[model samples]
Target chain A: MSVLYSCSHLDSPHSPLPPTYPSSSSSYHQLDKLYFCEECDAVRCDQCVAVEIASYFCPNCLFDVPSANVRADKNRCARSCFSCPTCESSLSIQASDVPTESGQPGPPYSLICSGCRWSSKEVGWSFEKPTGIALQLQKMNHQTEIVQSEFDSLKEHLESYISLSTPAPSAPSSIRSTRDPSRQISHLTQMAQKALHRDVGGMVAYSARSKGRSTGKEGEKEKYGWDELGVYEAKGSWRAGGESVLDGVDILRDLEDSGAGGMAEVGKRWGKSWDNSKMTKDVLPQRIPLQTKLTKRCPHPNCRHLLIQPDTKSIRMKIKMVAANYLPLVEIGRRRRRIPSNDMNEASEQPTTEELERRRRERRRTRGGIPIKEEDESMGLPLKRGETYLFQLALTNPLYDPIQIRLTQPHAAKDVNTWCNVSIPTQHFTINALKDAWAYDEEEEEGNDDFLIGGSEAGFSEEGTTTTGGGSGMGTLGKKSRLSILGGQGTKKGRDRETGVEKRSNTSKVILLVEVLPDNNTGDRVRFDLEVRYTYKSDEMATPTEPGEGSGNGEKRGKKEEYKNFTFWIRIDLGVVE
Target chain B: MGAFDPIATYEKGTYIETDTGNKVSRKATITGATNIILGGKSIIQTGSILRGDLRRSTAGQHVVITMGRYCLIGEGAIVRPPGKMYKGSFTFYPLRISDFVQIGPNSIIEAASIGSGVEIGKNCIIGKFVIIKDLAVILPDTVLPEGTVVPSMSVWSGNPGKLVDTLPETYQEAMEAKCKSYYQRFRAT
Candidate 1:
């Protein structure tokens, strides 16, 4: 029911095209999600884009947290923003209900959750002031202080051991050369005259350095890549397996009464991995995490150009090279299935199907005659086997100048689930250039409106049901004027009744016939990929090529308009067949 | 797609139409008429309640409920301002709902500010002082807690209202078009 373009992840411009297997969900993306790298001339998806944080800000307070304090603040709001421990929503500081001697609200302020009606009073956390609550909480123990002090003591204990283990920079190199005989101390040899340590090298120097350096503690440092630390003096406070298990008996008793409803969910304990509480009541409110705006670049190391650069101060992007600007918008609409006709016009919606059947009959009359199905017009009906369905694929030109589009099935799609032959009646077509509403004359509007009212099947269908992103804010009047131009004279493709393809304004609609084949997997939606190659004016002037290929009219010899071709693959999904 | 949908014709005298094209249903209950301001082209459906009476205790004139253009308050929805005790006294804060915001049926919104192009689905309980930024979507049956800040271009869902996904860049224009089309489709039979 939707169309998604595939990104190959890497682009090698001159190499032969690789067969695209777009069945993988990760490889396909909507046009808006894709970026076009001009240097490489290829589409890039999020998977192939390099992202770097530009700025960090708190979602709740909207404060731009400075980079220096980001680590110290632990990527949370520095001021007074905190979520509720119970519901995880942001908490509000409320004054206590008790009245003062002056008949004003009391000084005791507490955090409250309006959602679950949770209060800090239950946890014995009452602040003298409503503001700067985080600073006030820091003064209290909260178990964090205990953990911090123990970690500090451990670091101090290891300080002396690390310093003694480190070899001094001024130490005699003769001892180091003695430890490793293979290493030549070239610099030490230059300073050898000042201190004649050459005899100090080799066997005797080895014995001097090996006395204390042979300990594996030095090797353990290199093996595990741990930082050098000092002395280890075990304290009475630090005892292994010393905590009592009987203290948790109350928690078990509470669990028996309240069941698992008293327990905290896994998501609530995400950032509190160091000391997470199993009981919901024991969990305390934490600061909300900060969000970041990221700058995106092409993943290619050689071609690391900025694809998206967001402004640090605002939501606006300084530079964006989205693929929507470069590619033609393709949309499939006006779906109709072919039904058995008793009596219909000889010049039907499809002339090619009748011609092909006639040719097949002439070649082999012994075979059963092929039945010509009529256009049913009613859409959303389950497709029948051996029936033909016609679809209108509208390609809106993105460029200001006219472009020629050639849509072809590169090869038979290898999808095993769906069985349907999708064919394009008109392989090649030229779409008009996109223009502003004011640029289009009013006469054209009236002319196209007539087509809409007169065209039998076009008064009110899902004309704007675009498979991709909808049309850019073109006024309703302009869009209606150019939606249908049926029975108009001197059109480029004059045979509208035969090919069933029409053109109005910048959009060109083509007839796509899908013939359903009987299969066991008829429940699956019919899907296929199309390779669209568009030839557009490149606008190169430095070294212009021959001017004959500019606009197909072989005109404008003086003007330098080089044409370039770009090809991209798109996968379309049709609803399930009956 | 909304442009192709059938016109939603309401019976005559059901909705009172203003010169600014705002449609206020006759059956809807609107309190504190002097404190509420409905922007041009907005619609208040039947059974909806706008509590503009929850104004500040101060004597001077103050707009309590200020809704913006093209906003839609669905049936049975409650729009009330958030109030709290500040400086030894209780005072109500003004609720500002901006342009193109659609609050679905039976939802209760006591938020301080609901920004432009926000779509709050049916049966949602938007808590007090919840500031939902532009182009955000709160899914149906969501229970957003008090002071929850829903950022721009994000989708919020679930009881506690955690961000689930983000909207595309084109969502702003798409939402504007949808709101405009829906307003145009709504008419008198």
Candidate 2:
């Protein structure tokens, strides 16, 4: 199941060490999830890519939340977007039948869930306008106001304590004590000026300090207790009179007795309202949370290229460097059993009626077995010991240039049983150049004739036999051999017929003969790794350098078509053995 | 054939082109065609069932399945309007499918609204009353539960689909081009 090929033993030009550190497990991922870093020439998965937020927008309203306003809105939708207290579905604005005094049909709006039929009217909530429901709800709720005022008073009380706890200011003998009336007079003048300027906050602080200092008895100069700060209560406070905590406890106990049916979920309670109301009936509708877009970058510190740069408003990536675009798309399918000619021998030998009946039962049993009998069947076929299965391994070249592919099984340890021996009939094959669909069709027709003639002749005679055939007439002989090779092409045609695979548009398919050994002890599933080495001309490496900068002008002028070979490994998990 | 992949090739003339430039597969089962408003150049692939007969119970002419331009209803995909009990009566809601929304093969979409540039991959089941905002992608085999709200620029996947990733800003342009090209590539030869 390992989709990515990561090996420490492989020779890399970039890595300093041998990469023998405790590496992660085989990183398996889909093609879309993987990114290719061109700078590092490596594949990076989601686990390896560094992600950053691109933009934020409300999930329900789909309104783009500005980063500046995001904190103020507490990362929730500011518009008339509310989830149902029951089903959590987005609530739609429904207009009530009741009209205004003008009789203009200016009806009040109530939030309603189209899916669950849950309406805000059930909670006795209604809005004059369809939009700005959150703002209206905040103003209408008295419980929130009480909490806000209490929080403000507590913050104010803590502010005084924080300011007084700071180290005393270094005195220049000016404010050594109250005995220095000159310093005290200057301080009073500064406070008077602050008051004239209408700096109420500063004036109040000065007055409080003066009061604390004047009320202080002997030997209690610096010891200003909390009582002297005075009780800073919220204006029009009703919380103390009502005993809100005890009331809340009683309400919670009543809800608990009524069962969990009317209780809000933990996620629903924490979503928007900080009020920990246990009952779903008391739970206010929450604005949907905003979701953020992510921009992915290469995790490699030195090669931090933009792997995926997502646009905020669209489903497209501004810059997408998927590994599928750079690497060959390899697919394994079209499995067929290489059945031996045992049926021919059975046909020649006349069987008795009892034996024929037994054979019929055996055939029926085989048909009902786990390993399905079909040539075109693909995937999850049981692999039996001492049985050979022929599969089509197709390699599609992503590059425009025709690539030469070499596929082989990775060398396994001696202790590990070679459960399956996969042999590529055609080890080295050149894939066609990538082109348009029409161009491919035209090229294919012409290439077929050439391939048939050339392949047959090549298969028929050895290199030594061609040379010995003669000097001037060699071309004619080769052509004649090809023409005759078509019919008398012998075992080659049969082999070609048995391994029916083709290539198209930079895609080459070869028959992979997987012969299971007699001693396959790897249990139900047969797993193996394949090493594919492909050679392609790297035109990108030849960046035009300044003429005669380092090398001679002659060498610089010539185009350097460097053919590089890259090797990668992929693990194939062939399903259950019979 | 030299290098042709026979298994990969589709049958020629499988799709029947209408006068409005819509390449609708002849095999597709489209009911109540009069009620289905297909904007120009939209493709309805083979075996796709568009339930246009499911209209609102209210006594009025309603367009049950209204698709925008360049939208592709993939092979075998079912596009139906979501229905629910409203005011003591079950009523099928009108489905609004915006432009450049490509629904993959075998997906069942019972959504209220599918916004522009949205791609629902193969074998996805978009549940009833689902509202998918613009530029969203529902990955293959995702099963979104009922009443799921998919936001704009988000990627949703898995059963009871959760928002996994967000679409990039350039997605609209890319989807438009992709739909256009896919339409052009589908030849009736």
Candidate 3:
């Protein structure tokens, strides 16, 4: 697993065919890429978000393109910003030092790629000014004019044939007289039938189709003889000295002479210079394409709330609804293998034998007290089946107010091969509210006396965790009551043997016992899902509108308390079984 | 997937505090220590290499590496001044690192100047003459090109680093707290 943790999208959470279930591919996105929709209370991924282009700017020059000019410019930079045809890097304008008739160095410039040292002079291109190279190339290039005239002539030749096939409003009377008698009678009957029943839509289409056909029997006016139809040649109308069938042969010879490095890649030739047939030398530089800032909205029909609103001037998103901000950050790190209780008893019975010597070596092997392992290495080791390992599960609250979290394993995981049991040592615990980092230093120095007083003033001391859950209520009595509830409950302080790691702060850590049971059909890996439900107090206060107060009693304001709960699931993959 | 990391337990005195209030680890290799000037409360973690011997060719007592206050060079990180050919001979340029600059573990920084409040993530390669402006974050594994100009408040990531995102308005305060907390957490057994 990667450092990034994400929620798996259970597409068919209630599918009956668990054995043949198709897992969703969206289970592996980084937290930064996932968006959260508050309205739908569901995570919206990139696959589901409706992306709309907010602004388009050239990646090289960073100039915003006008919407009207986007189509004309073919969604590329119009301000003479061309990338290298070979390296695809932005090309810079370099001026040449050729002397002019005025006895001064000329102001002639050429497009040059600094990365590959490719210059426009190689292709015999030079310009008086640095700007508008594309416009100048189109004006002076003779090959482009020939291709343009050829396309125009083809369109002109096909104009009459296209118009002739179209349905005509008026048919010539001389051509109608020379038409086939049998076919003319059938056409007349259909037209007469349509006239008799004008409301019939089916007969209208039949008459329209018949009118589109040109009658071959109509040769009365001799507009074109049957022999003349075969002599129509579109290529004969080409501009003088433009139609050269030897152009392909000449290009092939040039390609055979040039080096392989001179030819552009298929990707580079496909963009902008699409009609450039000379593969080796004719590939021209293209304008840098524009990049867009996207505005993503929820795809849900009922709730189309904005998910991502990117700022145009800066890289910051104006409205970034990432799921990481909403969900509690969970990190699992410390790993330690547990030695069986029976093994210790067996070692004690051996006294000075080889078994006792082996125990001494084992203690030396684990001499680091708590073996420090890398996150990747710790997960790499296989866990023995039918063994129980103690771990610490910590939850950090993202809100300003203290939150109560309830974590549980579901009865069944959809299509997993194996499942493990997770036992929480402490069922209910309150996590401290997030505060400014410097404030923590001050709170630590004042000791627990001031802390207890502050907790009571918040009126949240009853079921509170000492650092966070205190508010105005029973004052000092509230702190005493909470102490009594936790007293003798073995809320284990400091370190414990067999427990991997322990530390206390705004992040609440609790001991968890994960037991992998021995199975007849054993699998290499064991995976399970955890359901996390958290209840947090809403910041928005509601006031009761009762009329029991005295007149002008706005000074004695009362606040209503509101709380909300959210549930999400996380899958944990315990790699390999010994 | 859920395993508690044992090494994170705080153990005091991992860093040796000098008379100047700079917390420098004894394990850190500091060559030409006389040429390095570290401002107060700066940290040089274990296995870090600080090369202060590379000086200008024509210089008379040039300070090769100068780090300002609250700077942290993480474990296994390397800080070396950029050098280039000058007047037909090679010369090393001075690396000036401003206050509140935290270079993450295993990062190799040869930049000319690193501005204040710039936090470079782990395994980043800051190329020669790279000018990083204040309040910038170079994400993990970013390999910036030579002469890259990193603008203020921008977040750069990936190889041949591109501007990926911008820092929030409260980034300065957040970064200061994070650096302070990391320094506080480093301790010896």
Best-fitting candidate, scored by lDDT:
1
lDDT of 2 by residue, A1-578 (tens): 22345432212312111111123233444444567776666666777788888788887667778889998788888887887777666688877766657654455888887656788988889998877898998889777677677788789887885455333565554245435555345445445544475433354456655665587644223343312344576655454445477877887687778776767677767753545456777776777778777788888767678988877766557898876666676766656775544662355244444554454355435643444343544455577775667776667777777677787765541234545656665677666456565654454343433333322324434321221221113224443342333223222332343333354335667777675654556465565556777776666645343111122312322366655566555655667677
| Model 3, span A168-258: residue lDDT tens | 6556654564354644444454455445754223443355434433544353123222112123455434344343668767766776787
Alpha carbon deviation, residue A425, candidate 3 (Å): 3.7
Please give, for residues B82-163, the per-residue lDDT of candidate 1 as tens digits.
9887775899999999999999999999999999999999999998889998789999999998788888778999998877
Candidate 1 pairs with clashing backbones: A157-A231, A158-A229, A158-A230, A159-A230, A160-A230, A161-A230, A161-A231, A162-A229, A162-A230
RMSD vs true structure, all candidates: 9.1, 13.7, 12.4
- How well does candidate 2 reproduce the true complex, by DockQ? 0.19
Name model 1 segments beyond 4 Å from true.
Answer: A13-23, A152-245, A341-388, A394-403, A412-418, A430-498, A502-509, A520-523, A538-560, A576-578, B1-64, B69-80, B83-92, B177-189
Worst 10 residues of 3 chain A by lDDT: A12-21
- Chain B TM-score against the true chain B, candidate 1: 0.97
Q: Tell me which residue pairs clash in candidate 2.
A: A311-B168, A311-B169, A312-B169, A315-B171, A316-B171, A524-A577
lDDT tens digits by residue: candidate 1, A1-578: 66777787874422122223334556677876788877666788888899998888887777888888899888888677788887777777887788888887767998888777889888888898878787888787456776676677877766654454344665786456436633334223323422563334544335434542476556523522332332455432433423346647877887888799888888777766656357887788888788877788988888899988877675457977787767887877667765544442232444354554653344234223554444645445666665667777778776787788898875646333345666776788787677664544443444333333223444434333222212222233354433333113214232233344466566677878776665525676666777888877866554332221233433334567666777778877766777
Ranking by DockQ: 1, 2, 3
Interface RMSD of each: 4.1, 7.8, 8.5
Candidate 3 lDDT by residue in tens digits, B1-189 = 122323222246666888776888878999989889998778898899999988887747989999988899998999999997654478899999998999999999999999888999999999887888777999999887655667666798876576778665446655675666555444343
Which model scores highest in TM-score?
1
For all predicted structures, in order, the TM-scores are 0.74, 0.63, 0.61
